[model samples]
Target chain A: MKLSLSSSPHQRVKRDTGQVMRMVIYAMIPGMIAQSLFFGWGMLIQSVIAVISALVFEGLILYLRNRPIERTLTDYSAVLTGLLIAISIPPTLPWWMTVTGVFFAIAVAKQVYGGLGFNIFNPAMIAYVVLLISFPAAMSLWLPPTTHAGITPSFFDSFSLIFTGFTTSGYDVTQLKTIADGVTMATPLDTLKTGLTQGVTYSESLTKPIFDGGFFEAAGAGWGIVSIAYLLGGLYLWKTRIISWHIPGGMLISVFVCASLLHLVNADYYASPLFHLFNGAVMVGAFFIATDPVSASTTPKGRIIFGAAIGFWIVIIRTFGGYPDAVAFAVIIMNMAVPLIDYYTRPRVYGKNADKGRGKY
Target chain B: MTDFRDLSLQGLWKNNPALVQLLGLCPLLAVTATFINGLGLGLATMLVLIGSNVTVSLVRNLVRNEIRIPVFVMIIAAFVTIIQLIMNAFTYELYLALGIFIPLIVTNCAIIGRAEAFASKNGPLASAYDGLMMGLGFTAVLVILGGMREILGAGTLLAGADRLFGPIAENWTVVLFSTENPFLLAVLPPGAFLGMGLLIAIKNIIDAKIAAQQTVTTEKAARVRVTAES
Candidate 1:
């Protein structure tokens, strides 16, 4: 009479979806602070726009689907998606474009595929790719880090630029990007790719003002610090067991290996492994985007394969492909292969030898 | 003979080649970037369908069953060639714009599918009617999908109309809005696929609504019957 009649063994993780998402958002704060200090307040403005629009779209879809809007919105998945997209894009992107991206991410990419868990690809990345392909000019308009530019755009200036495509003083993003030499500053990756394409060696390309800290010191001036902050966030995620070590571990190792091999072959042509690790969105992508529990490989061994393949593709695409950054493309490509990866890497049942033939039974 | 009304409904909505049967998607997706391109291709395919259906029906008995596929294909190929020649002579610009697709129409599954399924069994006149209706269904889908893509991709409607019609039709192009930066995704192959998918989804929604209404009416009638009996 005293024995409880529950169906199965009962053990549960105390953290809910909302709690886990909150932790992720907290982890991103360090990186966000770093990004703001270096890239200006445009990122913060973009994040606000994205989050509001994302929440609105999420609410609308939940209402249409006859689901509980408040409870689902509390989970903060849409907020995280909005944050990811906000951080990934050029901060000077117009408000309408940011809203368009958030709409597609929440309404089309997430809800159309039956909401958060059922989505096949990362919604934030899909939105980024869509915006990038649709408006190539706007997508690549990055402001030089404030540390190098010697002028951090005021919050009002960034807000005005995002809304009206110009600051109150009427300086456009293009004009702002112009450095002391009148050469328009670009991202470190963009400068590197352009240099290499124009027949400049890797070392020669690093001599550009964007890599002011020296060739081997860091990826680029502010980029390296922002990447380190993200790495710290990622390590926190790993230590807290919020994300397993397999995906990020495999990704970092493979990126190092691939970049090392190429660097060894021709030091002048290929950048070092540290450069690859700290440059662009590679760190954020490896730790945050690719570690998405829904889209990424689930099996222990499959996660390694998934992460490693993504790293390899990132190097290949960044070096040889048209786009300077390859994180979104690589993640989306690997998302398509998750089903196959899972099928082959299934864990063996207890008392059944995986190497033994099934016919022996 | 099948009722003309029933055949029209089947062709236009119930058993649409592009939306339901999903046949001839190669041409449907490939050439639908502009309205004129779609209209030109649709007309050519319709003509080819009509000719092949009538021809297949006429020779239904002479060709043996075992080799019927080869015979049907030959008839379809001949019609495609005739249409190709006509377009080449009349609409040279549009013809060139469509490029390899006109010849590739011979490989379109919808034409051969109708010939084998409907034409080979029906009389010549009935087969021709079916061919026309089916062709109309396929063409409607192509035009709609093309219009969707063109408007979104380029912000214009009936663009390149002069290539389809004559010089007077040049002004027929309607400018919805002009943008320096066009939505390139809508102009690409992926846009064609997404447009096609949305069209099919819309058709299914309409069909489902009609079915639901019919069920509601039937249920009301049954409830009245039970009330009367009680």
Candidate 2:
């Protein structure tokens, strides 16, 4: 028997799960580094814990189900989940919170939904939201930038703080923030929320130490650098064709347009487009979390709609809702609408007669 | 005798009122934020279930089939009212915490469902036992779910135990870990749903594993018998 070579159309692109997941992991590195730099090493340690736990859980579940564990483990989807969870959490969260989030992300979100492509909700976002609502205090504990603190946690301290809840200095991670002039340090967004509630004008609140050198109002110092890095990584993915431009592009545009409109109406109340763009997980969410293959819309048009809806909802919830951050909630809400969006936005095949028009058929 | 066991098993697992039957879910999901809370409600439910079941069974032979549904509902409502008043008097804090859910217990389909389906048809002893087992099963799940949520949400167990069990349980909360930041999501409604889902998934998985093991053993035994015959 002779083995024949096929032509271009017959020869497929040769993509595998491992390759796709690897690209995603690669795309996440710049953002991970930025998180480590700004938030301190807690995120990095959490990432490590999450990644290891996810892989172990994934493997265990696969073993229980009698699936090919090694092959599935190599795909790096578990790694992506870890990265997402790490970035979403407070850098100073305790070890068990990390473990619990990973456990839920893998066991409940992924495995119980039949694993990988079958999960209806974004596993990482669901875990993050669950942790956030369940542990509000831990979830909201953000330290000021290292520049303000005069103390940056060493990599080892970061590790210790996350696991043991105390740095080598005997100070708990929550106590390490700068307290100058009787003012406690807070994240720029948190500061803004509290300030606004206290009737502080947006521009006046911008003078707070947390926003000292930050590029835009309400953007945490050093956070914009991370956002920019994530944007760069997202652009690289788009350039390399690793991800389509529809979802990210649509999400950015919608957020920009919406924030602009809100700012135009009342600049005093609403944050600027730049503030919305460069702050709290907006860029990371636009490019990474919202683009999950399973939970996102399948069709090109649907992807755009899904992305825009998430952006729209984020703005609405952030501006008016109780939570300081709305990315996770927005993503989960949009996840539920993906199927409906895909159904309505499906492209018609060439030369195929149009289906019955509304009630006419 | 096996019939009794099967009935108990059916109420507890196979036809669980809260899970499979999806009856009494409102209260089950709402108040199950701690083990003691779940236990409190579950015990209250058991009282109502038993009282209603016995009353319905006694009147089952006297009432016409056409009006049996209304009669059963009234009996369940009456028992629920009695249970609510007693709880309000004894466990005021818990009663306040449970609030609408206690009265809403009147609408708990599990109580009415037993009255209509089992209690109205079965003998008094069986009916009462069924109600007791079903209520206990429901309470057991509630406590487990509540414990899971409380532990995850507040890093404590039996938080505010005094609310349900009174002063002995005051400060009975065992802190699993003390963090300035408690997980707020676990105590929230969404967490309740997630915890409940995990519980259901766990039950299903155990059932699946047992079924698979049974199938394997039966297959092996059948093959051995066939080879011996040959």
Candidate 3:
């Protein structure tokens, strides 16, 4: 054989699964810190629990399926799923519930669909929604941010509450939800939604004590700060080319256009565009969850359509539907439409005159 | 004798109506929230199937080819009406529980399917046997699916047994465990789909195991004959 001068590794491929996954995990760091700082140590503890369980389940399933275990674990998809599930849930969720969500995320959502890239739905969102639907009472138990509540539990107390559903001081999660004024502490979006449903105007809903500490009337105290943190992290992801801008751009534009129109029509009924953007999971979802490479649409045009539709659904569901925050439902719904969107949005080949939307001859 | 065994096997497993053919899925998913409800609907469906099958088989030679479908539908409809009236008069609670589904049995493609594909070409005895076996197969799935939904969703078995088996069976409800939050998903329609998907996955796993075993035998045949000689 003739001597070859080719160097090893042939060539380095950019954006491998592991690299992309690492980037995603890195992007979530600032957001996670913000969530824990504002919410408490509950999310951090839950994240630890979820990541551990997710890895365990992932390893177990791979072993059962008789595959290379190390290769799958190093991908960090499980870690990201754990991270997403951890942050998305209410802080006061019980330990076993977080474990249940992780189990469902890895075992059913990922493994049963042939694992990782083959999954049909976003595993974390599916697990979150399943937990939400299954345990509505526990899923809705959010402790107000430390800034608003003024009652800080030590790290150990947060751990005890999450693990045992009670603090060492004998106060349960429900007790933690009630502020000093005897009113239950709800998520800013939840409080606003409830107030509006009770026939309060948009501006009046903002006048409640929950919004008392905010510089603006759009988002609740501590929530807007968290959203801004996520937005900064999301922009970093975009700048690094880890995530494309088509989805986020489409989503924000649609939300802004839709919210402003509705607000212009009847400002009494609709929240302003700024409020909609900063509140709930709007920023995080537009940046992180909706941009999930596996479940999101791949084509350029399909991406825009997919993101716009999710934004549209978020507004409709939040304003009229039963739920207060709707990013999970909206993203899952758009995930279902990915195939049809991709089918219709297939790009035309050069010098080809075919007009079939299905990309078939 | 082989034909009889084949028919039985086809109905019970090989060609199960609910699991394989996926016929009459509405009642299969709807009424399968409880075991007794499944049994109630299953028995009613079996009665209609047997009656319609026998009648269709007996009159197969006389009906004209062009109007055969309409004639078969009419016969099934007649039996369904009789079954409905009998259910109304006797088991009123179950009748009410099963309600439109009992009347809706006339639309079950399994009954008409057997009438057209099997009974119309077979003798009355075979047709009746086919009906009995197929109906039992469907009932078995419904019963199993119902059992899953009930046990998982409500933490109880036969919770509504009295609807079918009378007041004496009311005490048969067994609480698996007491929990303030019953897995409402299992009793909900989504639970039915999830349970069904799991079942299908289980069947596929079994099939794969059997296939793997078959392949293992062939591999074993090629084993080197060491026998302390190598």
Candidate 4:
């Protein structure tokens, strides 16, 4: 009788790392498009700069380390890192700063930690944190959406602004900070934070021109569109089995549950759960950063715990911590705990008896 | 010679006060926002180190072993007081800028560590030299790390130079490129940690390269021996 022998119980999966990474890139497209439409061409320019820089830096480091450069480049992890960083940064960030961020993300955050699977923190989030802390002025320089300002920067202008630090017409970024009034618009989250601290009520704070057009109802206009697009992408990821539901579900539930409790206790002091959900980077973080396969927990229960912890930390830090937006810090903090979570929450082996303790037999 | 090299290497890399030994981190992280800040503290620590090491060595045989820690600490505190007064007299601006760190040097582990490990066993001359080398090494790292943070964070170098070197380098601060705002992360405590981590990483890479070269050479020699025997 003829018999064939193969590797034990082997089952090949059709999807590779490249495909998975590419799907994420594809999913980010709608959000990127929304951002461009509302915000301007700066995000697009930054995205391109980030992707190219990430690739080049990744390639250089891999070559220096004697790793297979082509194989590492093909996985698209670096591209994903770049995209996340690009989206997080102010669209008008100078070209060199963007390059510096990408290089740091790839070289220090990813490669220095033994690269890829070995990295303890999310590379993109690290870059965001680095940029946010380092260049607060540039990082906080968010232009009013084109709808509000009636000025949509041309692609060439954005490109020039990024590369040369000036608009095509020779206006520096500082001059372009605000549009109609002396309002001096800050990000919605930042406004809320500063406003609350200055003894302004939540509702009163939302009355600022920055939140005009009934947009803060859905997290202001431009950011709301971007958030919804990210949510759609996240749902697609969940449905397609690209990611499991544990992290997103857990994170969203924790945020809602925590925000609801706080709101109930003091309605005037706290924003609604919906406000917490739709505003800032919570949706993006819930779907994207928390779901990072490498830094996040592996086991089903562990993933839930990890996600919930991040959500909880986000709310706590946002409310009590120094920073207005705490998603990046929260995610990085929880990233450190994944291993312990996975260790304790490991599922039982399929055939092992449930009652059998370590000392039993 | 042996004591000096070992102490210098220990302070510089192997047993770095800030990195490996994790000593005096309060001042290391706090005052390292700029090169002048770090240099000022580093020089202060160096003076204290030399004074304490020499004093500790001189009294090594006189003090009872049981009461030695307190004695060593007292000596360190005394030296720190002297350094503080000198700085307050000459570089009052730097003394003010460094603030609590100058007084806090009395509690720095690197000072007491040398007193315990090297100075307690060696003669005064050797102990003093060891303290000098170790202090210089620590100061060098501080200056380098401070420079990196200042340049990246503020896009300037030798910021606050007047505080350390006097009015000559005052406004000697060249704006490498003016940003609308400085990089806050680099100025914050986290930036200090990250900058220190990168410095350590660079040191590790150099060590790894040297180790790799040694292994290659050893393997080549082994191969040559086998071939000759065959």
Tell me the deviation in Å of residue A11 in model 3. 9.6
Task: Give the true-structure RMSD of model 2.
Answer: 3.7
Interface CA RMSD, all predictions: 0.5, 1.9, 1.2, 1.5
Better of 1 and 2 by lDDT: 1
- For residue B41, what is the lDDT in candidate 3? 92
lDDT of 3 by residue, A18-128 (tens): 889898888888988988888899889888999999999999999999978999999999999998999999877888888888988899888989998898799998888
Clashing pairs in 3: none
By TM-score, who's the top model here? Answer: 1
Q: Rank the candidates by DockQ, best first.
A: 1, 4, 2, 3
Per-model TM-score on C-alpha atoms: 0.95, 0.89, 0.91, 0.90
lDDT for residue A150 in candidate 2, whole number 0-100? 58
lDDT of 2 by residue, A1-361 (tens): 9998877688565778788778878888888787777778788778888899999999999999999999889988998998889888888888888888888889888888899999999999988877877677778888777666656778888778888888887777656764444468877778777888999877777788888776554576887788998998888878877789999988889989999999999888888888888888889898889988888998999999999998898888888888888999999999998888988999998646645554435
Q: What value does the lDDT take at residue A53 in candidate 1? A: 95
Global lDDT of model 2 = 0.85
* lDDT, residue A153, model 3: 70
The candidate maximizing DockQ is 1
lDDT of 3 at A31: 86
Q: Put down candidate 3 lDDT per residue, B156-181, tens digits, no spaces.
A: 88887877777888798898987765
Considering summed lDDT, which 10 consecutive residues are worst modelled in model 2 chain A? A351-360
Please compute the TM-score of chain B alone for each predicted structure, in the order given. 0.96, 0.93, 0.90, 0.91
- Show the lowest summed lDDT stretch of 10 residues, model 2 chain B: B221-230
lDDT of 4: 0.85
DockQ, 0 to 1 scale, candidate 2: 0.67
Order candidates by lDDT, high to low. Answer: 1, 3, 4, 2
Error of 4 at B20 (Å): 6.1
